[model samples]
Target: MADVPTHLALGVEYDGSRFHGWQSQPDHRSVQQTLEDALGRIAAAPVRVAASGRTDAGVHATGQVVSFTSAAERPDDAWLRGGNSLLPAGVAVRWVARVDPSFHARFSATARRYLYVIQEQPQRPALAGNYVTWSRQRLDDEAMHRAAQVLVGEQDFSSFRGAGCQARTPMRCIHQILVRRFESLVVIDVTANAFLLHMVRNIAGVLLDVGAAQRPAEWVGEVLARRDRKAASKTAPAGGLYLVEVHYGDCFQPPPPMAPLPLSGIRDLW
Candidate 1:
């Protein structure tokens, strides 16, 4: 008798510096392609993975959720420990569990969170290069936080949308946004129901201008009101961005994912 297919969910984390991005690409390596290959070896057949969100190039992830179905009869832990052994150093399967066939990684997600870490100093980070964004000027995180409040609630984000973004609409609901500092590091944390391509990065760019005193906090509202992309600041660097969490509805008992800490631990800043 044929083994019935088992629906599986995995919490995966990766150092985005190791791949082009999360999605598979024909010419460039990707986190999805690498993970699928390792898991395919364990399933003894081809495997396909769908992630909660498609992170961009150079963006790290600490709580990426993925779903796949396999007919293999290996123990559940095989997907975690066995796959890790076959995978390279930058990525790992953090957890594995059986899931209802109805659950879809992309569709089932209710909210997503991201953190953008900026190292503020005249000197560039040595060990933290490519994992944190570098800024020459010290920023006023308070001003940035105050300005960000305009973004809450369902609103049109056409000012931040990418030209090539294919989302059906320019509207999205931002659940929360916080800009704070830990010593020389300024972090921008955002949680939203969903995002358009480069949306968060554009928001960060505008906040950077506010923090640097180039623009007043009220300018954020003005930019949003304009509904034009050209009115916003340049898109922030992808390296500073990290997909830190994904939220599911009440029925799922999801594990708490770690924060998007920089290579230099946050405590080190103190």
Candidate 2:
């Protein structure tokens, strides 16, 4: 008799510096491909994984969620420990649990959170080179926060979306955006119902312009109204971006804390 397939969910954390992205590509190494391979080895069969979001190349994630179905019947802890043993140093399965058949990692997600870390310094970061973006120009965290508020609520994000973005619609609701400074690091944390390709990076670019005084805080609203990508600043670097969390309605527990550093109480809007 054939056993019923078991649906499983996982929490993953990875350094994206060494892979192409989270999705599988033809010849390039990707986070998804790596995880699928590790899982396949454990299941003794081919495995496919679907993530809560698809992060681009060089983007890291501390709380990525994924779902898959298998008949291996391995214990939850075994999936966590065994998958880590097979994965590379840059990636690991942080948690694993059995989920209901309806619990999908991507579709079941209600919101996604991203964190962009920037180092404000004349010289580049040495210890955190591949993990952060550096800017020589001074940034006004206050101005950035003010500018980002224009993005709250549902709106067409064509100005910030990637050219190659394939989402059926350009409208997305940004639940919150907070800009703060922690020592030398400036963190931009955003929560959205969903994101278009390169959306957050483009928003960060525009906020950088506002912080540098090249553009007024009101410019963000104008760009949103224009619905043209060229009106916004160039997309920021991928290294600074991190997929911080994915929210599900009732299926999974909260992810482990990867809390931000101490902040300067810059500003944040719910």
Candidate 3:
């Protein structure tokens, strides 16, 4: 009789500035390739992994979840410590566990959360240049916050999706969106069932325009109604984007959320 494969889940954190993306690509560095290679080494055989989401090139992640089936008999900590020993500095296996065979990393996820950080300053950021998108112009956080609220709930997001997105439907549900500023940094937090290619960046680009007074807050609603990608602002730079978390059912537990300082502001973005 053949041995049944053991299903395992892992949480990963990576600095994506150097990788091509999350998916494996020929002749290019990828988070998947780096991780799978490490896992294969630990298992002493080829192992494949499926992630909760495939993040784009130059986009970072702190709460990425991945799952794989393995025949190797190893304890959970072995997957974590052993994998980290082989991975490069850009990526790390944060945690590992054996999950029920029914738990799939991607499909089982309830929602995904992302955060984009904009450094609103005159000169370019010297300390955190690789981690933030720099903007010289001042941004109105209140206006951006108000404009972002229109994105809540289920709707067609074709206007925000990038070209070559493979998702058959343009419709997606956004659970929450918060735009706030701390010191010189403006952070945009969004949660959704899933995301299309360039959706978050595109949304950020448009909100930046609104905050900069280049467009009216109401224009976002018009853009959404148009369903034309051309009507939206250019995609924001990838450096500022971070995949913050992926939500799962009671079968899995996620890590703690990032805690930032308090934000004070008026209600409307005008």
RMSD of each predicted structure = 2.1, 2.7, 3.9
Residue pairs of candidate 1 with colliding backbone atoms? none
Clashing pairs for model 3 are 142-269, 143-269
How many residue pairs clash in each candidate at the backbone level? Answer: 0, 0, 2
Regions of candidate 2 where Cα sits further than 4 Å from its true position: 260-270
Candidate 2 clashes between residue pairs 3 or more apart in a chain or in different chains: none
Most accurate candidate by lDDT: 1
Give per-residue CA lDDT, model 3, range 107-202, as digits (tens).
999999998888888999786777888899889999999999999999999999999999999999999999988778798999999999999999
Model 3 lDDT on a 0 to 1 scale: 0.88
Q: Which stretches of candidate 3 lie over 4 Å from their true place?
A: 258-270
- Give the alpha carbon lDDT tens digit for every residue of 1-270 in model 1: 899999999999999988999999999999999999999999999999999999988889988999999999889889999999999999999899888999889999999999889999898888888888899989999999999999999999999998899899999999999998888889888999999999999999999999999999999999999999999999998989988788888746568777665634554321
User: For candidate 2, lDDT tens digit of each residue in 182-226?
Assistant: 777888999999999999899989998998899999999999999
Better of 2 and 3 by TM-score: 2
**Number of the top TM-score candidate:** 1
